[model samples]
Target: MTSTLQPVTALTLDLDDTLWPVRPTLIAAEKVLAEWLRANAPSTAQNTPPAAMLALRAEVAAEHPHWAHDLSAIRLETIRRALRKHGDDPALAELAFDVFFEARHAVTLYDDVLPGLERLASRYPLIAVSNGNAELHRVGLERFFAGSVSARLHGVAKPDPSIFQAACAAAKAPPHRVLHLGDDLDTDVAGALAAGLHAGWICRPDGAHADAAPRAGAHRFATLLDVADALGV
Candidate 1:
């Protein structure tokens, strides 16, 4: 297949829904977190149901705009606040977060992801660029990436050119020489294009955004394997 790309030297990838079904992973993590809270902090668990916890998290995020890029901080504060409100020890928030984080890493990747990463990684330096707190090492995919640049570490999130620039720097390649592949149109495609990198939209068939239209000048693919094929890797 013909590629709408420049001579690509390095690649930046978005995590979350790009590699795995993030909603299921998140739901599972929330369940694990709720179970942990019930066992260790019954008061907080009793008062904070799933909906209440979601509201608390939203409230925490709204109160701390500076922490927009730090999902971990927002979640931790939300847990702390919930614990405090229910007369539970706020210190348990750390343990609760650990349980949630551990569960978050238990992601079942799309079938094409492993082979696609192998093919692409053989020819290009892969840099993970994401707004999430997922650790590649924890996900057992660290060896496929040259490095990672996350919103938590960079103090900026996607659609912001700075984080994209940081990913390019991590790959040791110019923006124009790097191709970024992701699922989100605005944060990944438009973001990479805005940062002068080629953008590839991974629109999996079962994805929630499967029907979303591709942006002008963006390459669209059904899977990571399609990306490797388009790149002739």
Candidate 2:
């Protein structure tokens, strides 16, 4: 006889690399944001090119450790600093960040993500837990999640047990009843395990690269579809 598995009360999901590839998404958003700056804030654009803009973000991060977990604030500050350096109105920073933020939501989900998440959502309440600033509502994925706990709001990022614990709380489940899915072994798997939750490593689709095995017990999923199957959702 096939053994039946217990259903998890809730799921804590990682947003960035788990739902979609984040690097290219950010790069594309940056390009559009730079174009906007060049058109409206010329001097600021001249003062902070793409490379220097990255440097400015790091500088701002170092100057305000409190804002380190708040990516939106860091980007806004970076723009404000750049505009102020170029003798532009610092208030324009919000407009500039809005440009980037809008572009940031223009993401292409991995083929398996949508269908898989939908299936999982039917079986369990999903809670978003991420260090990234990606807003699920903006990305049109909020419908699948019951709640969200972000680094910016919590004042801490993952690899720290607090964020994971916060997600479990949001999902109305204890840590042991929640399963966390993420692309990074260290941030997702190890962190979830450390927080006394089950962890699952979401392997990339191409199978070109494999991460190191997580220290604690965990599951490996080729796609979010595999995750649903494994969980019997």
Candidate 3:
């Protein structure tokens, strides 16, 4: 039951944990932000910094059930409002946002990032789809991708299919011709396959995903460079 695989004309990537390690970056940024908050908004910082920041985010998100899809807005508004209350000055609100924005831009890309992106971008249109803050792709990684989609813009997260569909549409490519690369098996592999795109799982260097046999038709690459090689371009 062998079949000829179609050439990849488009490539969609996940930002967090795929091209760059996001969780650790977020943790590091949170630490910095917590210190800043403690200095600027000491009273509220106790409940708004570090883990408390994430907890408040969840609590506020639960209040707006209709806004689960656009958590960035919720988060931004939450931070802004919390800072306003603590500082008693609207100007401090902007400072809080600036701190977060700067911290986010400090994310470290993986070792295989530039070479792989250069190789693939030279051949096909490259796009990014991530369920993170929209700004992370737009203002953050704008130089890397030709186009992008985030839950903040699409109003839905991955594993939901619509976001992937939207990314393909933005790239002007059919799902079958697009190769989706990401770290999460369910969000990237299953979701892309469900939406009819080729899926490539970006496992860790330790080969943790070697045993994960996705039921859907998919391929696994240890790094972005391997993915570039897989396409044979």
Candidate 4:
């Protein structure tokens, strides 16, 4: 028996891997940040190996478990600690973090993303909902979205219904009317389904999420264009 699908009035999208490949973006951003560090803070740069920077992140996470949901806080604290220990001025950590943040937003969108977003945004109120720290204004996609919700500001990450609900609220729509798309099955699909939003799993070209098990009500698509086709929007 087929059930009539609910109409999609709005959308809540994941930022990191759905629109752009986040790993490469981060790797590029890290390289640019390292270059800045080498030029401006050589003492800290000499002592802080890339791996040690990761270790500092872990240390910050351990000491401040409450900040687990805020990536900016964790990264900033890690930078501050590194600057302090390496005899660099700790006050400069804020500036260093800003440098890295600017680089982080230099994302290359997937070929289909911009056109697809334009098409979808014309029909529905598109909401950018993410657990990551990407700012749409920085990414230059702020004009396409009606609103945004983030884990950092909300104090809860995805796979928790609170964030999903918050995204729905941002859209000024009920959960059942908003379709949510993301790359992570657990966070995006499971979280949206649990919160009663329409869920779509975006499996990127890398085939990284091939092992995901099917959820009863979820839609699986390769791109945002496919999402429009699937929804008949």
- Using lDDT, give the best candidate's number: 1
How far residue 217's Cα lies from its native spot in candidate 1, in Å, is: 0.5
Estimate the TM-score of every prediction. Answer: 0.98, 0.94, 0.86, 0.95
Candidate 1: misplaced stretches above 4 Å? 1-3
Model 2 misplacement above 4 A = 1-7, 207-211
C-alpha RMSD (angstroms) for model 4? 1.8
Model 1 worst lDDT run, 10 consecutive residues? 1-10
Question: What is the clash count for each candidate, in the order shown?
Answer: 0, 0, 0, 0
lDDT of 1 at 225: 92
Candidate rank order under TM-score:
1, 4, 2, 3
Residue-level lDDT tens digits of model 3 in 130-184: 8876354433456767888887778888988888889999889988888899888
How well does candidate 1 score on lDDT at residue 90? 96
What's the lDDT for residue 44 in model 2?
A: 86
At residue 91, give the lDDT of candidate 3.
55
Instruction: Give one digit per residue, the lDDT tens place, for model 2 in 109-210.
Output: 999999999999998999999898999999999999999999999999898999998999899999888889998888899999999898888878563336
Superposed Cα RMSD, model 2: 2.0
